[model samples]
Target chain A: MIPDKAKELQERNLKYAQIIQDAMSGKREDMEKRIKELNLASTPKEVIHSETSIKLYRFIPVKKKLHKTPLLIVPSLILRYYIMDLLKGHSLIEHLVESGIDTYLIDWGIPGDEHGHLTFDYYIDKFLKRAVRKVSRSTGVEKINILGQCLGGTIGVVYTSLYQEEINKLVCLTTPVEFEDAGLLSVWTDRKTFNIDKVVETFGNTIPADFIHACFQFLDVKATVERYKKLYNNVLDENFLYYYKALDQWINDKIPFPGEVFRKFIRDLYQENLLVKGKFTINEKVADLKNITCPLLNIVAKFDHVFPEKSAKALNSFVSGPVDYHIISAGHVTLVVLFPQREETFKLISDFLKK
Target chain B: MFMDPAQFGKNFMDPTEFNKQFYGQMEQVFIEKMNEMIKNPAFLSSISKGVETGLDGKKKSDDLIKKYLEKMNMPTREDTSKILQYLQKIETKILDLEDKIEDLSDDLKNLKKEYGKSRKTEKKK
Candidate 1:
């Protein structure tokens, strides 16, 4: 009788397993089809004025009037800049433009073997600083409003700290100032376990896609799985599929972080927690947060799993600027994209910059 | 257990009485759980913290619910529980692997030291 009961349980379990497997396979097929459709549908627009090194994609403001200072958007190195300007309705870039803000976004080109030796100082001092100078010179404005998202936010903060005179206003979205408080990513990147030298040596300027994917997976393993399942179920709708594809493309669009820059980032920020401790040194000169004296606006996602509120809030203590910090009731991406008009986040940012 | 309509009518002519009896049992269960929560300081603290953090959004609420369910000694949802268990196992495995790597590193260091000593002796000879 006991053997019969055990066999019955085994059969039931096997049936359940089969059901899950079928569901997963169906979901995968739907997702792949949707992805292919999206790739076909997407129209890649070329920049009106393209430079040799960086391509400038311009999205003119919907309203004829422009804000006093032209806003420059800097997205993270891990993902594409289009995530900020995803779709017309859900796009932060569109909303900003419609609200009469002059915006220009920098698309950090994918790094090559030549960029392997590029250090953090090069990014902050050379690329970003040079970009700011060029923009300022072109616009004939002494100072330009600068905004950075994710890792770009970190770079923005570093830039602002070092060269506050060049920046009129600074805004950071979901930026991590205190690396020690940055949760799993911080712990994982710490010196003891991370052999960055081997990775840089092997891959040159580019870190493997698997490594980046693994870091994101570690953030929320269940959500990562469930998100695709949900996407699969909703793949029939063209609009939903477009949004999913845009998001998927942006998510999978991993850029090779210049090895030397990455090395400095991990060593200075994660290993030493130098930014918050006020010990970060740039070009043998200390990059002190106290040096930043611009009007600062720091927007943090209340429910950000990747960059926690604590990590973002650490900037409050470090910066000597006229700072205003607001916690938006959205996740990292939604904090910028969703409810672009209704949410007080956009209005607050606009008002700050306008002043 | 079939009751005659006349007998049933006679037993409880009022619907209020039946409802009172039904809800009285539910009230007792609710109070018992509440009492259990209050008695345990850790459970109480966790519940309060959960409520505090629950204000963030859906993700925070879900996390709070999961934590609350664990604290209440209730069965967790299958997917959530499975993922949590898998993560715990992975974390443990990673720690173990790191320990082994550290040990191997130490062994290598000692081996290198011994080789250096042997080479010095060979040079002296």
Candidate 2:
């Protein structure tokens, strides 16, 4: 007990000395410059197709061991796509490319008023179909793999249900499928209180990014404060500074949720819990999850605030495919944010894809 | 047990980073007691209303900014969107051409198959 106290005191003194030395060093200007100069999406990519609100990029392969089936990454409409392609050693795109996986990413660019009118039909039916066709035609392969993140997984699951023949496999990471959990976001977006039609009518084109970001920040005020706190405390450490700046860049880069998609997502999925019910229809056809016959790899996090375990486990219900579930110690973005978590997640994905 | 070294440090320093055990215990001792005193339902109701009001304020400020930029004749997202509208029109035309090309390819394949069938029939005759 005495030795433990001495060790604790010594550790405390060391931390204080580190903090004081960092403070005394001219790190203020250095930190400011680092924050301002930080850039993201470092992996080399060629825009294979570009449309109004979407830019489909094919990441240049780093090795010659190319696979026949290509992989397309579709992220949620909530933010920019650069979070997946952050930097050299930390990028999922880089890892996939180096591992000889032909990778493509869909950049849902700034949603305009026109995009506001686009529903899952337009995304799943029109945009995704075209993107898939473009990739398949370019590669001379009919079926390709898709790994969708968050709401993008919902889009993938729905698309696979409808157009199973077109896709080789489906991957969902931290995908929120059911609204059974009484999480704060779910409770807040409850139809009884949060009227979707009214929000659409009021906001017109899109739910402003500022509003969405504000709500996200409101979820864990403590976490946000702690992030900056850690950054400030480790201001002198170049490695920590780089990591924080990369993540901070992604956290700030967000686009407004398109109004039409937001309305349907909130009403049908969030409010009515429609996706898992085999009742939801995109493009005037039934999107029964049972119709997904391809291989499925569902990666759910244990403590996903946005998509809690109980909510994300709804994938086990009516999936007629070979379902592989992987639960990890992570939050929503930790799969890409933390280095070890990102490495493990990507390795799992690569192995699963190859298998 | 969901922890990293940094997270362990944070939770040790900040109660906000409370572990499951600590959270349950602290809730009873602190957060829950505070909630009981303030009535969390009423507190959350006010916070929710405040958030809605905050979002509304943001929307209004956005509209104001749009108008201000328009008045100044400065290029804005609206202008870029207008240009993209024209680009979309062209993209649609390109897609139409692609459809036509696909149809032509199908026609060529059919013609080749018919030619082969006719040659076989002639050989049989």
Candidate 3:
């Protein structure tokens, strides 16, 4: 190697040595105590309806109720709902609630073998519709606005198309609309090579949460390594430690996806790229975007690795009504954790819904 | 441009700035390489192919296990799953019947209320 390169390599080794020394100097007990103090999803809410395994909750009023249309936040079914309200002051739901936005969330309880046959159609037609009706009756509103993130947003897109009259507005966050050239995860789930039927048959009923996490971890091995290294480097900082614990806890706390939903999601959405092509269907009904007349707001994370910004922005072209497309300067996880991005996302949801 | 020895020494002496620059460069290079690897068609295609092959192997192994279990007169996972599915179907049917019964009961009560009101009116006449 060149002389300058050799010198830099030596300096880098020295820096690593110093970093290791500083990292070791932090008190072990202090780190343990801080981690133990990290609690998540402390927001109070009442379960208004429970249909078998699914539950719909109404967050207790924090700010004075001003809005007629209650905003329902759909939980990505594969993951637990509390990531939206991970911690006090850092919560997306809390910020909206305190701002006087009528907010609700669906807790898709962990799927068991009994729920294995519950397809996307069953979820959207039977459960989602019932929840919307429950909210509408209680709030005395004809139509409600829905905010769905990630896979939940994909569900929302389908539901809004199917039941256009029920929804007043649609807000999708980091939702993959056009799957072509999307990201590493998309590439890995290519239909021709991936046997969805075999995987679903083998797993049976519900795919374990650990399986999904492992797959996501494989998407970026380097990022995973860098994240842990950064974690150790900042273990001494109490604030960083708290948020890290909260986020990490939320990521690990996941729900097994209903098997039928998983199969359809992989085959139809990811494999065929049907939603963007306007050929996606549920229960023999065409899920045409033109059928969706509700005002749409597509919130995309610019640096999202799972659903890149280009894939998410495709929503703008499909929607018939006015589409408010907002791009934030954050990655997928940071879109929820970082204060500025989270705050901005919360603000955008409330504002777009009210419009 | 080659840095003189004195300048390099000055940069190294300020450990904080040097560390920041070093890590920044490292992160930039790491991300670029990762992105390149991810976007490579051969890499992605190979991953899918490998996963498919592994899946096929799993399915074959599962089939063999089920065959052995059947020969020993043991209940297999498929057998148990089918039983569970049947039970779930029965449970769902029962729930539906219950809802229908509740609706019929409400209708009967309403009919009785109207009869009572009509009888009272006739008695007054």
User: Which candidate has the highest DockQ of all?
Assistant: 3
Residue-wise C-alpha lDDT for candidate 1, range B1-125, written one tens digit per residue: 54344633544654443444555566567556654544355664564455334333544565777789889987655444356446544654674565578669969999999999999999999
Q: Which candidate is the best by TM-score?
A: 3
lDDT of 1 by residue, A164-200 (tens): 8888899988898888858667755655555555555
Tell me, per candidate, how large a share of the native contacts it keeps: 0.00, 0.06, 0.39
Window of ten residues with lowest summed lDDT in model 1 chain B: B47-56
Q: Over the stretch B1-125, how does candidate 2's per-residue lDDT look in tens digits?
A: 55455646645654333444465454456534543533256665776677667668866886898899999998766676567656776776798688689879979999999999999999999
All candidates' lDDT scores? 0.68, 0.76, 0.78
Superposition TM-score, candidate 3 onto the true structure? 0.78
| Candidate 3 Cα misplacement greater than 4 A, ranges | A1-37, A63-66, A218-222, B1-35, B64-75, B90-125
lDDT of 1: 0.68
lDDT score of residue B76 within candidate 3: 91
Error of 2 at A265 (Å): 1.0
DockQ ranking from best candidate downward: 3, 2, 1
Per-residue lDDT of A99 in model 3: 72
Ten residues in a row with the worst lDDT in model 2 chain A? A23-32
